[model samples]
Target: MKAFVIERYGKQEPLHLAEVPEPKLGEQDVLVRIHAASINPLDLKIRSGALKRILPLRLPLVLGNDLAGVVTQVGTKVQRFKPGDEVYARTDTRRIGTFAEFIAVAESNVALKPPSLSMAEAASIPLVGLTAWQALVEKGNLRKGQKVFIHAGSGGVGTLAIQLAKHLGASVATTTSSANVALVKSLGADIVIDYKKDDFAKTLRDYDLVLHSLGSEELEKSVGILKPGGQLITISGPADPEFAKNNGMPKLVQMIVGLLSRKIRKKAGKQGVGYSFLFMRGSGEQLSTLGELIHSGAIRPTVDRVFPFEETNEALAYVEGGRTRGKAVIQVVALANQA
Candidate 1:
């Protein structure tokens, strides 16, 4: 199968097209003929060796995470999906390599694609969609009539997060550059702060939740905006000790995490607020629910660009710039006159 792989993590020059052996499917996995794949910030971090200590990878690793495709074969133990079923997923990080003609993912990680969207659009939803869903619904416990703020409103996750918050009956506020203010507003953000010119911490107050995705400075400012007892769920740095415990790290690592987390936890305690880190996980059931939302016209996929399969390097370059309006997809298979 033809795929793009990275022999060493560094610049984009290491990315090259090659014919690699097809992956062997596990007993609980399904082989998918990939139609489209999307690039996420995680992909760029992996390509740059920024996550080397955390997510160790073998050399010549294939690069991609989100995929939308058709099932070609199903594992013996897989009952939810079958041959010819259209599916989409944020595949297991350990088995990631969606930059190929085919990939084998566990049945538990994939769900039926939304019927209302094309393969290209569906490819954009899995990773970011799941992140937004888990952050707002599962961890944050956002309730209707609440007020929530999402950072980077024009980015992949923020675009979806805004809509999800609105769908759940929350009044959403978000931060973006001036150019994207209208876009985020259209996506249902009731308030849009121009991050380049305004301070979000000063602009918003008494928020029930803050979905953070920025630097430490922004994270520090986020606390001031939340009302007492409100929550801040961050996806960037500031790893919580609970996250370290959940991942089963060594005691020393846990202690280090505790030390790192103590400052934020203490600060939150002083304000009667809560703080935690969120690293998204795959859940087919949640994805199926999200698919229903998409299928029902309650939510829509937002794509900023589509690159050909062979231009994976260029796509990576574009995302690294960190100014995309939404998701960026790679069209792996040529559609019949769809272009």
Candidate 2:
């Protein structure tokens, strides 16, 4: 089988199309013939070795995170699916390789694709959907009539998070470029701040929660807008000690992470807000719930663009430049002469 792989981790390195051995199916796995795959900033970080100490992925790693595909085979213990089941998943980060013709994902991390979507559209949802679900519903426990600020309203996670926040009955606020103000509003954002024209933290206040996806400067300012006892969940780093401990990192690493987050934690403390870092994980059960929401039209996949499978590198470059309105997808298997 052919897969796009990186021989080494560097921002300057390009993905090479290489012929590799097929992935072996484990007892708890399902083999998928990928129809479409989505590129994520996580893939860029991994490719650049930004997460080397934490991830320690194998050399010659195939690159991709989200996949929508058809089940070609299932392992002995896999009970929920069989051959020909259409599915989508954000593959476990430990064994990510969706930029290929096939991937053997643990059955527990796969879910049936929403029937209302095309393969490329299905591929755009999993990672961003799971991230939104975990942050807004699971961690934030956002309630009706509450106000939640989601930074970067036009990015992959931002697009889904904005819509999901509104569906959960919370008033959503988000920041984006001037050109994207209308786009985020259509995604159900009640308050749209053009980050280029206005400082969101300076204008928005008394929020129940803030979903921070940017870096230290914005993370610092986000706390001021949250009311006392409100939560601030960040998908971007300076990983907190709790996350490090929960994920079983080395004691030294945990301590270093604690040090990394000390400033933000102390600031949130002074403002009487709760702060934690989120590294979204894969869960088939959660994906199922998201699929139902997508099917019902409560939330929709926002695909900014789709590239041919062989143009995976070009797709990555486009996303890396941060030009997308929603999410960018690589259509691995064309449908009905799709461009």
Candidate 3:
């Protein structure tokens, strides 16, 4: 099986294409023949060693998170899906390797792909969609008539977050460049602040929740936009103590994470708002809900570009460039070319 793997962690290091043995299927796993995979900022951070302390991957790691494909076989204990089932997933954190010809995903982390979408389109949904679902539905508890600000509305997570927030009945405000204002609006953003021209914190006020995904400067500003008791959930983050504790990090690591977020938490406290970091987890149940939304026309994927499987490295680089409108996908198996 051909896969792209990172031999070491470095900012400019390139992924090498290698023929590796197929992943072993566990009792509760499903073996999938990957049709398409998506690139994410998390992939870049992992490759650059930015998340070493938190996620510590084994060397020569196959690099990808989101995948859409067909089930080639199911493990003995897997019953929800069988051979030939079309599925998509945000591979479990510990076994991520979707930039390959095949992967074995835990059945609990896999969901049937939305029937209305192509493999590439379904490939783009899982990670970002799960992030949005966890942030808005699970954590924020967004409600109708409430105002929510989602930063970076044109980015992968932002594009989906805006739609999910709106669908949940919250009035959505988001930040992006002037060129993408229309795009966010089309995705149901009620207010779009051109980050290049205007500051989001200054533009949005008294919001019920804030879904932040940017630098510390923007994160601090996000706290100020919310009303008292507002929830600020950040995906791109200085991980908070709660997150560290929830993930059961070592005591020293927990202390370090706490220190990293102390100032921001204090600032949010002073403003009478709550701040917490959200590192999204893979969930087949949540993906199923998102798939229904996609099938119902309530949410749509915004794919900025599609790269061939051979250009997986270039796809990762493009995502690192931070200029994409939505998600970027790698077509691993051209279904049209298949006999």
Candidate 4:
């Protein structure tokens, strides 16, 4: 099967389409014939070797994370899914490669695609949806009448997190450019700051939680905005020690990770704010819950573009340009064609 792979890791090295051996199916996995795959900033990080130290992998690695497809085969141990079931997933990070024509995902990480969404649309949900779910509901424990801030409100995760925060009954505040203030508002953001003109730290204060997806500068600013006993969960991070420990990192590496987040954690601690890093893991059950929200129209995908599978490289480049209004997905096979 033809798949996009990186022979070497570097910013200059581009993913090349090559004939790779088909994926091996495990007894607890389902073989999905991918109809669409979504591109994320995580793909860029891995392709450029930015995350190589934390997530070391062999070369000739395929690049992709979110996929929506049809199950062509099911392992003997798989009970919930079978051939012909339309499904979608953010495959486990350790085995990510949804950019290919087929991928065998563990049955526990796969969920039925929301019936109301097209494959391209559903492909945009998994990673971002899971990120938002874990940040707002599970980790943040956001409650009604509380305030929460989500950074980068127009990007892939930001678009979803804003809606999830709203759905959880919290008053949502988000930062976006002038072009997207209206967009975020439509997603239920109670306060939308034009990041280019105003500072979010000054605009929002005493928040119950903050879902952050930016760098050190934004991290510092986000931590200050939270009130006493508030929590800040960052997906883009200088991996904290707790995250390293939870992932079973070497003690030396964990020590280094702790040193990296020391200053910020100390700052948060002084203000009675809690800080932790969140690296979202795939879960079939969480996807199932999010699927209901998507299906019921409580949350909707904001897909900026649908590139053909052949244009996966272009799609990645577009996402790297940092001007997307929402997510982008590569359509590998068009299912139903709008019925």
User: What is the lDDT of every predicted structure here?
Assistant: 0.90, 0.92, 0.92, 0.91
Best-to-worst ranking by TM-score = 3, 2, 4, 1
Single out the weakest 10-residue window by summed lDDT for candidate 3: 330-339
lDDT of candidate 2 at residue 271, scale 0 to 100: 95
What TM-score do all the candidates reach, one by one? Answer: 0.96, 0.98, 0.98, 0.98
Show the colliding residue pairs in model 2. Answer: none
Candidate 3 stretches greater than 4 Å from native: none
Candidate 1 deviation (Cα RMSD): 1.7
Candidate 1: where is the Cα deviation over 4 Å? Answer: 11-13, 337-339
Once fitted onto the true fold, the runs of candidate 2 whose alpha carbons sit more than 4 angstroms away are 336-339
On the 0 to 100 scale, the lDDT of residue 42 in model 4 is 95
When 1 and 4 are scored with lDDT, the better candidate is: 4
Q: Regarding lDDT, does 3 or 4 come out ahead?
A: 3
lDDT of 3: 0.92
Q: What range of 10 consecutive residues in model 2 has the weakest lDDT sum?
A: 330-339
**Candidate 3 per-residue lDDT over residues 1-339, each given as its tens digit:** 999998999998899999999999999999999999999999988889999898977998998998999999999999899999999999988788999999999999999999899999999999999999999999988998999988899999999999998888889888889889899999999888888888776777899999889888888888888899999899886999988898889999999999999999999999999998898999999999999999889999999999999999899889999999999999999868632
- The sequence of per-residue lDDT tens digits that candidate 1 reaches over residues 100-194 is 99999999999999878899999999999999999999999999999999999999999999999999999999999999989999999999999
Task: Report how far off residue 332 is in candidate 1 (Å).
Answer: 1.0
The residue pairs that clash in candidate 1, if any, are none
lDDT, candidate 1, residue 139? 95
